[model samples]
Target: MSLCFFDYGYSLLLRHTTEEAIATCIEAIEPARAALTSQLRNTVINDLIEGLTKHDWFTELDIADEPPPVRFSLREWINQAKEVQATVFIAEKQEALVKESWEVLKQNIPENSLRFFTLVLEIAPAVKNMFSFLKDSDEIPQNNPKLKAHAVKVFKMTCESAIQLRQKGEVVVSDTTLKYLGSVHVEKGVIDPHFQVVKEALMRTVKEAVGDQKWSDEMGSAWGEAYDQLAAAIKTEMKQQLEAAPKSSSD
Candidate 1:
């Protein structure tokens, strides 16, 4: 049988074995499960069962004859479910923050892009050399369509990463994507340190767009953590690429 079907059957069995107490446990988890896909929902349910089994809570149940191999104690199971419920609650909050923040962000993409590029230049003048396409442009970086497009893409990716991170089971950005991004940067002569500058510029743009009233500490921390994770993944890939590359003859 599919794990989904098994999960449902297990829950029903729990209701019979533990009575109304199981209802309270399910109640605590229903909100979290409501937004998840069936696959992820089943994963969480299975994880909860695994956790209970690891704690040997199932052995404590006094079912007549043999306990159906997956028994659970009401008190212990509820406690374990509460822990998973807390994670789901936090992910929901983070997802809300990302969505609301992006709404504020998309309102003025061009302006924010300008701010990001300007900050990037200010913090790391050397980065200007990397953007050879803008070398001869007399127009300001913010007004440049190419620069604006690049900024928008970066912000969009960041928003997507945050959303993925908030999803059940931490399904954030994929390793393949991160590796490709890192490889592209490596070809562009971009190093791991450059990501810090980019992150700072991006955060500054977000703050400017959202303003202090809407940009709470939680939002800042969430974005900060998300960026850090992306940067780390990219840097890891970059490091691997460098290590695998052929050494120079001079070396």
Candidate 2:
């Protein structure tokens, strides 16, 4: 089941219940005359009437006049994709953290290996925002073919990213393990040091190769710039709100 279906079904159910409850309340108003204040009764009736009359009030609800269903569905798809991607990312990071600990604990570990491991850890927190847009979707993509395509793209990117990360992880582990092995001149530490590098590299490598299609350096830079703009706007708005706050009695 997709997250979209779940959200839409839940919303529809809420709307239906609200309508039923309003009807029941209105019908019971005569019997329980004092249950609702006069203003409350008027407000409830007006809202119910407006909801009931909305369709009739609109003479033409053509496709152009209505919200684009495609855009709505696409947004839903993106949300679901982001949620699942985020889960994958956090899980990967957890595994990497364990690997990092192992590498740090192991004897004769080189600083070069530490550098790669640290680089891998640095990106985990950065990718946390990627999942903000994704939500659990239960809606099947039948209503929108574009959403289906987007789902396919997201899945493909995930798989590709996983494979590439695995390959790179192997390379990093092999290189680091050989260094550690040469330094210790022992065989027992091979598993600890090598596997740690492999695991951590695997987690960090995918920030570029996986998740969203446009998460490359260029796109990432643009996103950072946009985030700065958004933060500045929010700060300004907050400052304005503070300035407009009611003056204290001391004033």
Candidate 3:
């Protein structure tokens, strides 16, 4: 009878332990699962809008066929830019959503900070695209000087981050440079002389773009290597920026 009673007691203890473990798991997962759902919506905005902006359907603003340069309608172009800008604004509004989601995630899975940060990193490229969209907006040039300045600020920030990340081994330098080059192809098509000019100009500006920083000898050599490829790829973008920079209609 004592042996049977002891066996029953052990079973009860095991059952209690199992129940507690299950409860702990459910508590941990509930908030994280909810946060993941919210993050899904954020991703929809950042990724979807970015893909729309970066699409290669970027035809030259010149649409007429008669002679020298075709005259695309400024009104129509500006209207399109307004629509895109609205989308970006909508995405920006979701900043609160991202914060809430991250809070839940952090509370539930504190150990996953780096993973969450990396997930946030996924939106970095999309953020860059949003800035590029703003930069390419004819609306800013025609109607809003303030917005044009904001767009340039965003572009500068992205360029700075890309350069720093490349140097620190925090991100892929070549890929970031390529993305910048691709953005430059908006007004300037992938044609010959223009493309070559832009690429060269981008290379020349890298050091200035990144700002002056102290690096060890090893880092300096690594930076030199990274700079070589980026210098070649960024020429097209640099030339395009120079052409666009001074021609704001807000002048």
Candidate 3 has a TM-score of 0.20
Q: Candidate 1: misplaced stretches above 4 Å?
A: 1-85, 136-140, 168-171, 174-176, 249-251
Please give the ranking of all candidate structures by TM-score, highest first, separated by commas: 1, 3, 2
CA error at residue 1 for candidate 3, angstroms: 53
- Which candidate number maximizes TM-score? 1
Candidate 2: tens digits of C-alpha lDDT, residues 103-196? 3323322323333333433433332222222223332223344444443443333223332332223212233433433333222222233333
Query: TM-score of every model?
Result: 0.63, 0.18, 0.20
Better of 1 and 3 by lDDT: 1
Worst 10 residues of 2 by lDDT: 164-173
Backbone clash pairs in model 3 (N, Cα, C under 3 Å; residues 3+ apart or in different chains), count: 5
For candidate 1, write residues 15-108 as lDDT tens digits. Answer: 5767577777666665445544544755776787667657743556655676566555666676777777776666666667866887887787
Against the reference, the lDDT scores of all candidates come to 0.72, 0.38, 0.43
Q: In model 3, which runs have C-alpha deviations exceeding 4 angstroms?
A: 1-158, 161-187, 191-196, 199-251
